[model samples]
Target: MDSQSAQLPIKIARIGSTVMNDFLKIPVRTEETSATALPRGAAITISGSWKGSITISSSDELSRRIAAAMFRKDDNSVEARDIADALSELTNIIAGNIKAILPGPSQLSLPMTLETVPEAAQGAVRVQLQDDQAGQLLICVQPGLH
Candidate 1:
């Protein structure tokens, strides 16, 4: 059995909580996990789903709020870089968390730039926080020879 397949749930909870509090300025309540196909917008597309992704974006403008929270000195000016950095951090943290749970010999590939605009699509399981904004995390598995 693949190591990642076994520990996916635990990793999601850890990463989801950290990002929600640190970046989203909210608490993570709900959690979900599943296997699925990679969306066309994704940068890395392997045969089947060779990669996994965890998205932690909030439509409530909380991301803007997070920018403010991160840089205490800059409340009036939150640059696009700040938001992008936060997003990148989110991806890293989620990936790391998942990596921690995976069995030895399995490695997590680095995150690549996702050029497409991210839409608010439902994940395998969408977790809605108390702030009314929901966070979706998806983990995709690569094709394995049966």
Candidate 2:
């Protein structure tokens, strides 16, 4: 790894907590075990002087809660598109913060909603988090152009 790629510095738990707390008003705690690939999720990629990607996967309940929070409605009342939009926005916010501090000129791609996370690429870092109301959410960060 070169010095530039070393900027792949990440604080997954802190980032997750702040983003989730601020965006959804839901606090999260980190767990020792990594979170599994969830049925509902989102992923984004960034490339340039410093390159990497972040993938977020969550429990169905959490998905609903997130959508509910965004739409100001009950979890069951939220539509699938609402849930997808919420996840996409959350992923973008988290990735944008990361891209900002990195050795640019970095281009952060649009967030992509996923039915399930694909296999982890080589050199990926996965962090698991648990929320009191929503259960577990996973953050997988890949820290290099590769």
Best by TM-score: 2
Tell me, by lDDT, which candidate is best.
Answer: 2
**Clashes (candidate 1):** 2
In candidate 2, the residue pairs with backbone N, CA or C atoms under 3 Å apart (3 or more residues apart, or in different chains) clash, namely: none
Q: Each model's TM-score, in the order given?
A: 0.53, 0.85
Q: lDDT tens digits, residues 42-135, model 2?
A: 9898888878788888888888888888788987789989989998988888778766766689788889999878757778767777889757
lDDT of 1 by residue, 78-102 (tens): 7766655655555565556644544
How many residue pairs of model 2 clash at the backbone? 0
lDDT of each candidate versus the true structure: 0.46, 0.79
Against the true structure, candidate 2 has what lDDT?
0.79
lDDT of 1: 0.46
| Candidate 1 stretches greater than 4 Å from native | 1-7, 22-25, 31-51, 73-75, 117-146
